[model samples]
Target: MRSTFSAVFTIFVTLSVCAASPFTKRAVTLPPLNGKFDYQIGGPYTPAADVAVVTRDNSASPVSGKYNICYINAFQTQPDAASFWQSSANAGLLLHKSDGSLFEDADWPGEYFLDTRTDSNRQAIATILNGWIDTCHSKGFDAIEPDNLDTFSRSTNLLTAADNLALAKLFTDHAHSLGLAVAQKNTGGELGASGKSTAGFDFAVAEECQQFEECDSYTDVYGNNMLEIEYTDNGISAWNAACKARGSAISVIYRDRDVVPSSSKAYHYQEC
Candidate 1:
């Protein structure tokens, strides 16, 4: 009788271990996805009657009662960001053209690249972003979305994917340690590669993934855990068709490219 009881207990433990969520490693993927989560980057506010999960910029205070993704500009400098980086103090990470002009994203001109050549330097660079991560964890954020993992391609190969993998893991591991799930932003070059995601990212927050033919790459790995934000009508149509055909219940949100709030003329929001 004792032997039979022991065998049953062992089988139960195996099933429990296999059922944990990718984020907490304890819970399974949070309830059934509602399919209409919000993506608001202007920083979290009280949110309106329609907004589902509120996503704020990394600078805002985190809120509970909803799943929040802290948007940290991990790879680049701040938007309109020239004044932040002093040339005399931090120069190597800052990308410069032959004419000494900075490489700005135009949309987010403030961001600058961080030099991640050595572990020591990477940690030093991470120090700035880690504080924000710490704040996100403490402020009640459920997850983090560190943007610009693909900046290495933009860096003209001065930065390698290996450099990003190291940093990505560093950020995600630390976030997980604090009980916050981390997200991998765009990097079509190698995001779906086996075991290449150093971040141990729980879910993927892709921007215009449908418009770019990259949805397949992410959905293949994250399953329906991919939270897609389509910036245009055509993108929404394309993503929905693919998702419906597969019976995949992916969460989709539509926002302007700028992702401005409802108060602005450029304000755009939708869910399907």
Candidate 2:
């Protein structure tokens, strides 16, 4: 009886260790340094032949034969998915206002912030985002570009940088366990600077870092692993300057604000 009990306990311990091994260590792959890439979160289309990397929305299919980055709106609810979030099972994950109303992102009306103020809320949010990361892995994505890491700034004092970083660490840790690298999107000077190392972010996807003259903020941390996109509406000078300055060391592209497909009339794309 004593021998049997000891054997059973040993088996349980071994099983537990095996189950947790993946989360403890995995070989995560980072994006190619200075690789030409496309930002297609608006919609996915055929990337140019020279493009080595492509980013697409979570709902979109990965581009074949290219390093694909799956875009997940980790910080807030998508405008169209409001109903799903409003459902009882997931509603508690959303941040609420003083009046008990949903907190909406002013820049993006209809989009609501995810509550990361508490550990329970952050864990719940991480569970859903981790599922999305799982789907990205199953779809053959090389990495994840979690949008709105800077949502705390737009959170109207309800969410702090610490809250967002805590949630982001959950994301990066989960993504790495699945061997998927995570990108730090925007928030160049603040969270991008302070949280990049702590959160385990492998690289950065900056929108208009050049236009805002904060490209160095990302490059300083992510080095040549930075992927920069400058909008045409912001003027060509920013794009031109970025290309001339660190173009050889990093990936830089000019895209339209809408990021429409190449077939569209307003479509625009340039790379350096």
Candidate 3:
């Protein structure tokens, strides 16, 4: 149930782009821990304050010479991109309920779940995602923030945690093969559960970890190599608590839930 960017879900990017094959290269350097950072997945702007890292949606280009994290909605369908999925070669990959209706994210009206129930569907989806990863590299991004890792939690009984992690490994391996660092999008509490090193994730992009008391879970694995976003508009109460209690190594920031551009009247962004 992502509140940000739900209303403007019409934006879509083509998934057909050239990409290098996966699992043939080594992982790249991660985003600097404890560095200034910004999350601009909604829109991009000049760095707010010498931000060492910035995350932007796939529709946007990477910031030059910055540790850019390309936002890839890997687990579920973005509200705006429903048409793209419907028309995609892997259209069958969309999950559906027993009644044959679309299985939505419940929290987000237009967002739908991607079916990772089988290895075949996973590979097909990976083909499209790999193309996106290629775009990140071709556009000069240093890393990728694959969103919707928690989609399985909303898939009713159609998907499992194992299903999601399997898909995640595919993404991480593909990104690493392209020499791009990969990030765990949320505190799924599955990192160590899989018996993989950091779940093969180079870092994390946690949203309101302090509010949920999941900060230690991430730092326990990725350490300071993570950035967290807290939103006042979202009724987040831990902003102050996080600021007061967080270690210097954890980069934290506050933004309007919408994450509007700095120039927008709805914009709200801050750092701690």
Candidate 4:
């Protein structure tokens, strides 16, 4: 009886190890390094044949047969969704000033920062963001670009860098679990190298990095996996400078500030 019981226990342990192996080995697919890229977050349109990657809003469908990235305003409330965050269901998720007025991003008037100061608030925000990640996965997106990670800079001390990084880990971990890679969007200058690993980001989506002269800040971490967008308003000089420096190593594109579609008169797109 003792021998039989010991044998049964050993078999159970072996089976359990086998059952857990897949989860331990599971990995998310990262985007192709230095691929031709397009940023269509303003609205989705078919990409040119040579384009290897495209980023679209979460509400937009992924472009077929390309490495598609879904954009999520993970750190703040969208201007149009202000009412939803203000609603009772999402109370305490938005940061408030000492006077109890809602704190808003000065550059983006209607958009407000999501409170990330406490574990409870971060978990609450994650519940809502994870649902969006689920949709991005369902829509066949290869990665996630959680924008406004630097919202802490605009938080006027109400939120700290640590606060936002904590929430970023939540976003990245959930994305990875669904086999989708995550981008550390436009916060390299602030978060630096350690923050990249802490947040579990696979790559980066850096806007106006050339204008800010911060391309190296991202490249030091993401290498060729960085997708750079230089605004036309910043002039071709910034774009030229970026291309001259890292064009061969990373994906670099010049786009209009609005990122309008080709059909629009304001549309502008160029690559190096």
CA-lDDT, candidates in order: 0.60, 0.79, 0.76, 0.79
Candidate 3 ranges beyond 4 A from true positions:
1-3, 6-22, 190-199, 234-236
- TM-score per model over all chains: 0.77, 0.90, 0.90, 0.90
Query: Residue-wise lDDT of candidate 1 within 12-73, one digit each (tens)?
Result: 01111111123333331331354457776753346656544666776575555566777777
**Compared with the true structure, what per-residue lDDT tens digits does model 4 show for residues 115-142?**
9999889877876787787788888999
* Pairs with backbone N, CA or C atoms under 3 Å apart (clashes), candidate 1: 21-27, 76-112, 77-111, 77-112, 78-110, 78-111, 79-110, 80-110, 81-110
Q: Candidate 3, residues 36-76: lDDT per residue as tens digits?
A: 88888777788864788898887788877778888888888
Stretches off by above 4 angstroms in model 4 are 1-25
Tell me the tens digit of each residue's lDDT in model 2 across 1-272: 00000000000011111211236537877778888988887766788898989988877789888899988888987766777789898899999999999999776777789999998888877777777887888889989988787777877788898888888888788888888889988887876567676777888888888777788888888888889888888899989999999889888988888787778798889988
Runs of candidate 1 exceeding 4 Å displacement? 1-35, 43-51, 87-89, 96-103, 106-108, 194-197, 233-236, 239-248
Question: How many residue pairs clash in each candidate at the backbone level?
Answer: 9, 0, 1, 0
Report the C-alpha displacement of residue 157, candidate 4, in angstroms: 1.2
Output the TM-score of candidate 3.
0.90
Clashing pairs in 4: none
Better of 1 and 4 by lDDT: 4
